[model samples]
Target chain A: MSDTPENVAATNAEARNERHRERMVRKKTVMDERIANAQSERGLLLVNTGIGKGKSSSAFGMVARALGHGLKVGVVQFIKGRVSTGEQLFFKRFPEEVRYHVMGEGFTWETQDRQRDIETAGKAWEVAVELLNDPGIALVVLDELNIAFKHGYLDVDQILEDLRNRPLTQHVVVTGRGAPQALIEAADTVSDMSLVKHAFQSGIRAQKGIEF
Target chain B: MSDTPENVAATNAEARNERHRERMVRKKTVMDERIANAQSERGLLLVNTGIGKGKSSSAFGMVARALGHGLKVGVVQFIKGRVSTGEQLFFKRFPEEVRYHVMGEGFTWETQDRQRDIETAGKAWEVAVELLNDPGIALVVLDELNIAFKHGYLDVDQILEDLRNRPLTQHVVVTGRGAPQALIEAADTVSDMSLVKHAFQSGIRAQKGIEF
Candidate 1:
């Protein structure tokens, strides 16, 4: 019993098979249903920090997910003019359920006019605030609002306070580098995007539909 | 109430004030209780599609979030073999809860040996499968795996079958450009990044930390 070659091979195979089965179980455990169950009774997420990469992309994923579940979504892009985005284009597929508004003065330098940049931000903030209060709006992504705060175009205190009091049924997502510490502190969940690697580093230019 | 100039001015001012207050209320509604509740739940996500931007960066955001919550995480990067990423560098700060592995045969064409590429992929996948099965491992990120599938070095059906059966407490994330339709369909969530505009198109290379 201890020296049979066939028995040893069979034993080794069984061990390997068990390990394989275990891995499969672990992967399935990570599904959305499990995540939904693990979620807190309240949902308040703040995605902030230095502009590394993919902050807005992650928020967009959530928007799509919520929208798929038949929830309404609203998005306001600060300092980003009316330029089209892939997400905006995709969301257009469900125009009846998604609303997007870009309050952009383009880039700060592009605007050149400080007063105009401020005016544009002010108008966008107005729209953002309106969407924030609408309980029917399940998710709202504030793209690039951090730059507005970092540049003093928007008030951090106001942003945090408003977010703190936003509709209990709505989910707010803010994307930008250099998020205020106060906002981070007030957020129920904070995700800091730290870049690991990117192709652009290799002298490859950002390709359309892949980088926009 | 005389129809005096002062009375008219007072009424106009009140209306303007109400509008402003309404805007504030609207904005504040974005941080609702539902979003907070959702965060407590653990989940798995896969960000994949053709050569685009931010798939890994987006997944890293969740890795950071999960780490902040004291969850164990493991990362396996495929195709990106040569350089060190900021994510790996930062993860060094928390050696106990995080592990990083790079499974690459360098550039595809550089690997003139087809059998060698397949062998390298198989070796790395062995480790990835191990991580996927570990229940104590709360979050697992398979970075740039789509390239393996695209290159036909990895078996998609086998990997999907394993992922589908993984542990219930584990959350798995796969990030790569050009994710197959079958994988997307199998996933609880899928995001196709459409590039619209990118800074690289202007001849600027990737910036450190911002890109890699």
Candidate 2:
């Protein structure tokens, strides 16, 4: 007797399920091995760079993550001193946990004063150095520090040296566009955020709390 | 002598400064006009997707920004219910500000059961719909929802319809890898994070408080 349509459908479904299970079983084996091999844990040097929107936003998110773990965090805004961003205002609520500093006069084009910018960057580096040296600070965010290096306002070698010399267990997140090759080479984890689309391009204004 | 070395150096610096100032002045005029044109305000659909890190981290960062603005935020984490990430633990502190939900039975590969996965995704979508319907929730983070759609566990059309029907002033952030083309077109701001390097590839385990 010929099998019914319902029985044939059920048989097909079973075959598909079996195939899926076998594929997953193989994938699981590979993943388990990878997870098992990753045994070392220490502080990491993370870089967020490229012409993207979330470079600073992601760094601030890490700040939230660090704070959530009951860890002390430090933030040094290298080229965003002109405006008080949403992250700045929100992080202020956690004064006991976050050490926040805004150190730039403005963007390079806005400032148009190389000597003054160099001075400001110098001062910001000093604050960063202090944070890097502090063992108590588990995570340090150098927001837009890459801009300073890109503009020749700061020395990349010196910055890399400071990053290298930071507390062994203290993680640092450096963010901005045009991260120098040397910095990327030194970083443990680097994410290049590429802008696929932006609201501003579509005539949507930068909204409060969303884009500060 | 025609001029001393000091005098020539000073003259060159002055000329460079003048040129920079002129360039900036022209750029500022264009920027000012653009800023003036962007006077309208509304909620945005922000998408963070790619084969890289920090997609969800950036979403959580926005969560901090939203909370800083005293806005109510909802986070519906799909496909990441097995491990308790740091964001989950940290955001838990803000019970009054954030409504958090972890609604997956782990990843699809780990689950290895299409029928059960579809049911779990359905339940998660129900929760998301409720949040989207609420006007009080300023920001809704549908973390890893793209994966559900990619794996055919959920319908992309239905998801888009719900997103479109959300409160006019409520912003939504969708994050995951391999975001659908439809979602990208619908999004106001989309960031494609490209992984340059990862610590895990170097045998460094995902650390607590950082990777989680």
Candidate 3:
């Protein structure tokens, strides 16, 4: 039997597909069992913090994900209110579902006055607490709250207590650098972004839309 | 001088605005110098890996950011090709600029046959290399490539060599868990997601548009 190149390739592909099918069947069995075993469901407490970039970016991405599910989201910015970012503009399109309040006294260096920073952070936390209590909002993003906590502007213990008492089905996300140890322990999920190589280090100024 | 709530609030807001403006002016002075000093610009090699969620989600979010800037983007999925994710469906809308390719034989456990899994991964890497080399593509996302590397299906060194030779402005993102040491070292940016809690552990099934 003479086999042309196309025929030989076709035969090989068919064999591979068959093997792949068998393997997936076995895997599905295992996964099904595991899926069945996991039984509890509750709102998530996700924390994103570190020296690396994308902390706030990831949280914003989740806002998109939550919105894709038709879920209402509430966002409170602490140290980044001064910047009008692309995300803010995009999420603004969904005014009914997204409650985005940019509240901050800028970065610590810019603010200079620690007392004013604390008061502003306190105000932002008040908004966050309101969002957390409202069951209508499915997810609440506490952007840069870690910075406020790190600078001793916001009380971590008080924030943790409030988060613990939030609506049962309302998910919450905290993003910024230097998440406190207490907060980390209280959190259900934490992602510490590691700065590997930054474009800023190479003299590329933060590009619009990319960094902001 | 009776300070009703409205008068007090207005005064406070005006004072805050003045301070904010002054602070921003100083910040701009410093920032302008930094921006002027920064001189290098090149395509970044970013890696998002960890046990937490949002790795691929973050990478895809970058795809959106790049698109917002009118840049051409390419995406190659290694182990998640079977699922029709929200990102896949959304990005598909931009067919002209986005070269989205879902190439995989499913996860390692599902494939069962190591040889077949390896072959699938190799094919995917070939596609990744193609995207990496194509100057027309400004951003290339090798989604779940770390999973292939974690499974020992693809050679890290070979991938690194290709990335090193990519176009100067061609950004690449490698996403999935347990990114090999060499890949992390070579990457310009790395975010190690820290998983504190997972919805799946609580028996909350992955919903459409959120988990897919």
Candidate 4:
């Protein structure tokens, strides 16, 4: 006996539902175990890295999250001082909760002076170190520091040492491409964004709010 | 000739400076041409997908960017209607510019019915379709719609057709894991977030404000 069209559709829907139930049951078991075992809580070291464009964007979003929680936040920028970003402009509205610092001279091409870039990176790192040590600051963002770290303007070892001794209650988010292995090892969470496609590659100029 | 520690440090810094200058000069030429040729401007279909986290967070960051520019924005949340997210709470500050819609029955585990899930997804798509056709809305974020697309609850072809017919000046950002190949191909920009390390993998529970 052949099944009717209505019956076939119902059967297909039932089969899909059963498959979803089984998969989620297995996931629940794993997640429950993980959640049960999590007893210790402390501030996290999060690194957003890779060739994708959303690394810095995600880090800044976390800044918004931190601020929403009534947490004090500090932001330090390195190697990207030419353009004031939308995130910076928006966060400036809340001066009481956010300490914003744009400490880079500019891009290497724009500045063309390695000595100046190094000095600027040094100043930004100084700010980062201070932010990391401040227990009152709940979240600190080291935006684009990975670019300077990649270019050797900043010492990875020194930064790692500072991160190790950061305040127990202060969260830190580091963003940029080519994050060093040491920082990755030291971080509690790491997200590496992979570029499937970028608007810039398609001859789209960096717009004011989107790119900045 | 043997040199003092300070002299060796000074000489090394100078050599490093010289290398950076040469490398940057070459990089500048390439970047200049790339920047010069990038002249196109249009609204984009951006998809953030993969198993890694931060897909929705980045999408919301774009919403903030859109809002910062005083653009009208619409956000539709799918499959995450159970918990209130930080982005939703914060975006509610700008009620005039944002039209927020949470139209899901929670995760599949909680819903457990394929027919119900399909109906919920359809309703969310209806809201998204309305937003897409509205030229006054500068950006529309379809959060977690990929899950519906991944599960066959929604027709990918229908979505592709709708995306093709969307308002010319309106940007759409779709966020979730396991985006279909067709959507990826149709999208102007795509970012695939890869997990290096996740807090959940280390038996860490999702904390309030950070995870939500």
Which candidate should be chosen as best, given DockQ against the real structure? Answer: 2
The candidates, ranked best first by TM-score, are 2, 4, 3, 1
Per-residue accuracy of model 4 over A1-212 as CA lDDT, tens digit each: 35999889888878978887888777767755766898666788889898986887787767766666677889898856556677777777789989989888778887778888888899899988988888899888898889898878899999989988988767788888999999999988899899999989989987654666
- Give lDDT: candidate 4, residue B168: 82
Tell me the DockQ of each model, to 2 decimals: 0.04, 0.68, 0.25, 0.58
Model 2: chain B TM-score vs. truth?
0.94
- The model with the greater lDDT, 2 or 3, is 2
- What tens-digit string does per-residue lDDT give for candidate 3 at A85-196? 6667656666898898989967776666756887899999999989999999888999899999887888888889999999987888898889999988887667777776
When sorted by lDDT, best at the front, the candidate numbers are 2, 4, 3, 1
Q: What is the C-alpha local distance difference test score of each model?
A: 0.65, 0.88, 0.79, 0.83
Candidate 4 residue spans exceeding 4 A from truth: A1-26, B1-12
Q: Could you tell which candidate, 1 or 2, scores higher by DockQ?
A: 2
Model 4, global lDDT: 0.83
| Candidate 3: segments with Cα more than 4 A from true spot | A1-32, A81-83, A196-204, A208-210, B1-37, B68-72, B81-83, B93-98, B126-130, B133-136, B196-212
Evaluated on chain B only, what is the TM-score of candidate 4? 0.93
Quick one: RMSD of model 2? 1.8
Going through the candidates in order, the fraction of native interface contacts each one reproduces equals 0.03, 0.64, 0.36, 0.51
CAPRI-style class, candidate 2: medium
For model 3 chain A, give the 10-residue run with minimal summed lDDT.
Answer: A203-212
Let me know the TM-score candidate 2 reaches against the reference structure: 0.96
